[model samples]
Target: MGDEKKRKMLQRIEELMSYGEPTPTIEPSLLKYLDEAALRGILETLERRREKLIEDEKEWLAQFRKEES
Candidate 1:
């Protein structure tokens, strides 16, 4: 994927992640138009984002427990 396309996809993914809920299925037309490379890039980026969110959540919970104690 080109840098600009990748950047746009990353921005969209981040926006979805900010919702803190599972992402809904993307529009069919959007998926239909994407080449395999773009799809793979999106999936890879999303997985990284998911991992970061999981780590952030764990840290937040640990801090909360410490404060409670």
Candidate 2:
């Protein structure tokens, strides 16, 4: 795949993070792994990519559908 296609593939993973999803609940004992700021920043980046993927996918699908018809 070309660079654009590679970017598009990555967008699929990003799409999942953009939506509000329940975070993994950690037990009080494992709280050492918690990093709210890091998590938030990652989610912010994902949210942006997710939005773009959604738009691109819609166009991609529409074109496919039209071709099939």
Candidate 3:
């Protein structure tokens, strides 16, 4: 991919990492050398982690509510 496309993907990855818990940390310098497939893989892995975190949070909330009864 072109430099512009890589830059945009980097931005998206950064933005995704900036959100709530269970985020992965990667060095920006290392990311720049990777191809689009690698970048997408990273994004997909992070997305899966985020989904797991959300699921765990929902489970915790449900447990908490159950205990309040």
Candidate 4:
């Protein structure tokens, strides 16, 4: 893909991330450009990061409650 196309794709990915909970469904045509492995890797990475964020937020909240007490 050309630089312009890559930039546009990255922008779209960022837009998807902004949706927060319940990730938006990617269009089939968009995935058609990516291989299965690449798509899977991207999803797995996103899931892992989301899980980590949830865990971190839980820990922070617990500590916050302790400090309040």
Candidate 5:
């Protein structure tokens, strides 16, 4: 995916991760149009990237605490 589109997708994913949206918000029609492999790959990639971002955030907070102390 292109950088701009990928960034947009990540933004949406971040929002969805919160207690804001309903599960399985994807519509049936969109699913029908999507290629199964592509969709699965995108989802998996997003999931991994999100995990890494969370880990990085935690590390940053820990470092900040040490500096404060």
Candidate 6:
């Protein structure tokens, strides 16, 4: 992917990440320019990052509970 397209993809991924929920279905218009491989790569990367965020948040909450107790 070109730098500009990559940047836009990353930005959209970040927006999805901030939603703090499962990744929503990407609109076809937004993805029309990318091939299957690029689309898969973006989805996989987003899923991995989202999983990490959930794990980190869980750990943080656990620690907070420990401190409170």
Q: lDDT per model, in order?
A: 0.65, 0.53, 0.78, 0.61, 0.59, 0.68
Q: Which candidate leads the pack in lDDT?
A: 3
State every prediction's TM-score relative to the real structure.
0.57, 0.42, 0.70, 0.54, 0.50, 0.55
lDDT computed for candidate 3 = 0.78
User: How many clashes (backbone N, Cα, C below 3 Å) per candidate?
Assistant: 0, 0, 0, 0, 0, 0
lDDT of 3 by residue, 1-69 (tens): 887887777777876787844554556677568999988997898789889989999998887674544
Off by over 4 Å in 4: 1-16, 19-28, 66-69
Off by over 4 Å in 1: 1-25, 66-69
When summed lDDT is taken over every stretch of 10 residues in candidate 3, the lowest stretch is 20-29
Better of 1 and 2 by TM-score: 1
lDDT of 6 by residue, 1-69 (tens): 565665577566656655755665455356557765775587688888878988999988887664543
7: Cα error in model 1, Å: 23
Instruction: List the lowest-lDDT window of 10 residues for candidate 1.
Output: 23-32
In Å, residue 54's CA in model 5 sits off its true spot by 0.9
* Model 4, span 1-69: residue lDDT tens: 454654455445544465455555565456447754565567567767777888999988887674543
Regions more than 4 Å wrong, model 3: 20-31, 66-69
The global Cα lDDT (0 to 1) of model 6 is: 0.68
Best by TM-score: 3
Runs in model 5 deviating more than 4 A are: 1-28, 67-69
Better of 1 and 5 by TM-score: 1
Query: Candidate 6 has what TM-score?
Result: 0.55
Residue 21 lDDT (model 6): 58
Better of 2 and 3 by lDDT: 3
In model 1, residue pairs whose N, Cα or C atoms come closer than 3 Å (at least 3 residues apart or on different chains), thus clashing, are: none
Candidate numbers, best TM-score first, in rank order: 3, 1, 6, 4, 5, 2
